[model samples]
Target: MPVAAVALVAGAVGAGPVIAAVQGDPALPERTAEQLLADAVRAARSDPRPMSGTLMQTSSFGIPGLPQVSGAGGSSPGALLAGSHELKVWYGGADRIRLALPGRMSETDLVVDGDRVWLWESGTNTATRITAGREDLAGHGRAPGDRAAEALPTAATPQQIAREVLERADADTAISVTGDEKVAGRDAYQLTLAPKDEASLVREIRLALDGETLVPLRIQVYAEGSAEPAFEVGFTTVTFSPPAPENFAFTPPPGAKVQEKALADLVPGPVGGQEKGEELADGAEVVGEGWTAVAVLPFSEKDLRGLASQKGQGAGSADAGAAEAAVESLLKSAERVDGAWGGGRIVRTKLVSALLTDDGRLLVGAVTPERLVEVAGQK
Candidate 1:
């Protein structure tokens, strides 16, 4: 099977101990990281393997300012995207894994034999041809072993993942060995793995195992350097069994574009000659023509309303009527004002629509720049 196929199964199973090994004492002699991982692999391999199931996956990122973005800071940053796949995997000496991503987007399939690889999505409006050789895939890099392999530790093995707690759990990193959890209603062990070091590559991982089957219910990944987790995934179902032979091959369509780009070339450097007006705060550089953009930190609608309301708050009874009229007029004017923090300026002419983020910041895109600068600089 191709490495990628294995990754899908791993995603569902968490890592290692495929078959239920006799549950040693909850507090048995802690094994080394290597040993624990090996057991996991053994358990996983020795099983009435899963035949087919759906695997749901999600990936996100941890950026300084772009907290909600997915993947690395420089990678794709869609706030949230989800995907699922119909998966079939067979694990023996050499495993075979297959994935049919949800949706009719594409029907690409990957197969692996030792290091040799085969990929077939669709070709001739039916099945595609095969390129049989490790050399054919050399430039592409190693194929993924399973879904979890990509989602789990940066470079983790079933053995390593199985005993992730035994190796990394420390005072700062508290590893929780839960009594038992359930995946697909199967009794599973819930192992909560956390990082002892703040700077560790992984922040935390939750492993759910089927106690009877010795398979994983789910595995979750979090921010690489945060106390709070940013993303999680769970397998609704899992089975260990072989798939149809056709699942391993790929055939491109007659006129399919076979363009391939190196990973290094995918990086986005500073885009020049263009001003990108996204979510700019205090120190974002102003961009564009006939305008300057400024961000008002700690600014709120209530504060603006309060300012307008103050027009009548200090008036005597006789003057109260005039003060109230003035306050109403000021509030009306404030409502008409609008702004946006993009196109290199905070348009402060008229209000279009106001955006409120999860964080207590208001994204007010306006229509005029001069007034925007003034508003941003307000005390």
Candidate 2:
């Protein structure tokens, strides 16, 4: 499993929740559905106070014969997602946060303070940093960078999840305050989003919000027709009280090699920026809506090169060409799949689906492979 995980990190490896209907009435929300969602947005935006917790990500899918993807040690691909992991996390709002995962030797940390972001790897006693607006991407920077699969999904906060869920409120989304429950040791309200789109593979998405704070406490994603959640993430232990100020500060360990670079240099010019009147052709357009919205990105040689570059730039290693070669070798071993719509390789998990098409495009979504493939051919 460890070896596979390591391979997944090398490959940058790659969901459903189906909830049963409530039998009887539970505690009703004092606030209306709109009011509750608005409150959640406010809580997340206003939460500058320090918070600490243990995060759990459980993945149980039916994806078969897939390769490992990227992430922290022991937190890669198959086993890491299918099994349970305890990640100790501290947040001091957007600019300051830390994630720690224990490994065989030392703990791995992805810490961001101010303009600098640092990634610490186990056993090597090394740290890598990237400053804002730089050209070369660091060990996976925050938003606007590295949106691919990582164990820590730096941007996947409760508030962000809530925002995405609520922003898509429209005809296709059915919003209801289903019930009330306890989350992070606090009374909370249950909100369910069920999809009305027949093309969508999603069954439902549920969020638990603190009754007082309105911050989302948990999010579960269920696929069509499945009672089990394909993806679930929530805090097992949490505290709203401000975390110690020291949690936001960090100093590279003595003798640790610290290399700094700009992410822009690593990104292809077209993806990194756009000219005055030029617009993206099929680049990163949002399809579907509400619970089934998918992000389809234009992928070609440049994107592949960027991924290969990211592989080589990992903190513990320094082998750009070899990393690119490794990626090539990995791709060679992938199971080639074709469908009526088109031909491509399906990299999937129970909760998530992504495909690299023969037409130089990548379609990704929480929906099933069929949905992604359908979108792939259309675009």
Candidate 3:
């Protein structure tokens, strides 16, 4: 199974109720770091199971003057960058899943059942239906349900996050079994991974794996020199019982605007309609690897200004306005700097740094400003 598929399965299993015996730090035989890592990998490849739970995500990047919006409009990028969010999830094997994000006065739902997928936003009374391709339905590649999972506005589940982190583990990373711990009232083993490169802004990543199932129950990311976690996502409640089949069923209300899409429409093509194996159409790519990786994107100053001033003319305009104001404020507050790479604006936070170059590129990563500059100079 793919790593993401494993994450889905593991996340589903992690939703189950904890046994009474493992409520606290239950005594168990000590396992080496290697042993624990192997166990996690094996568990991820196991068959999917039924599970349901509530997931909580929080972030404190220490970005100065960043707006923290909540309530019904919290799904915006600015809102998700800060504050807290709660999501309810249900999983029944690979082809069935449901995720609901509730707000003060509205709710958003993503439901996937076999080859059909639905995204419904109550605030706007809009429904989007995506038909899965044959490959997705056959489970030969990325599934529509997985795409739905990625479409989540908030951070992914602990299992998914852990899978991404583990995939980047290599010689540059130092992995260890920190100790026994409990997460969401379940007994767990705490695993920690720290980057050896000093240039990486990440201090360490901690994952709590269920002792019984080896599924990730919680993930915490700490920035360099920070004692507290900069970001965290974990389950607050879990139950192993299968979700009702009706949860995956969705129907657009009367008078609701319905939009249809196909799975192929979501896939990105090569640059300038080039054939496969050509450059990316977006003129974007990742530089470096592992913890030191930096993302290079084609972004001009005009684009930045346009994004800051953009406004929505229809439904959800309030949220769009708020997001625009936040972006405008962030741009106004950004510091201008001239370096060997060229003159540009830089935004630095406790956990991440971004440099928008004068030459129409944006270099960003969870590394230091120096790393961004280094990557920019290479271009």
Highest TM-score, which number? 3
Q: Write the per-residue lDDT of candidate 1 for residues 1-379, one digit (tens) a residue.
A: 0011112221211121212223333433344433434454567545335355554444332111111222211111111221222332333323354444323343434444444333443421233222323332232333323321221122222322343333333455455555434555465565665645332334556666555554555565553444333333445555555666655444455666554332222222211111234444453333222111223345444654565456335444643454345434433433332335322212121111133222233433212334333343342
Candidate achieving the largest lDDT: 3
lDDT of 2 by residue, 196-274 (tens): 7765666777888766666677777666777776555677677877667777677897888877644433233432354
lDDT of each: 0.37, 0.57, 0.67
* Per-residue lDDT of model 3, residues 1-379, tens digit only: 1122211221100111211112445455688887888787777656545888888766667664455433223443223444566778899867798988777677778788887788787777888886655464343354446554544534367777777777667888888984557667667788888889998888888888877778788877777887666676777787777999998888899999999865445333311123323444378887887777777889977886576555343427675676566566667767897877688888887667788888899987778888888888888
What TM-score, computed on C-alpha atoms, does each candidate reach? 0.40, 0.68, 0.83
Give me candidate 1's TM-score against the actual structure: 0.40
Model 1 residue runs over 4 Å out of place are 1-51, 62-95, 113-117, 122-173, 199-203, 222-229, 244-246, 249-379
Model 3 alpha-carbon miss at residue 161, Å: 1.2
Backbone clashes in model 3: 2
C-alpha lDDT of residue 117 in model 3? 81
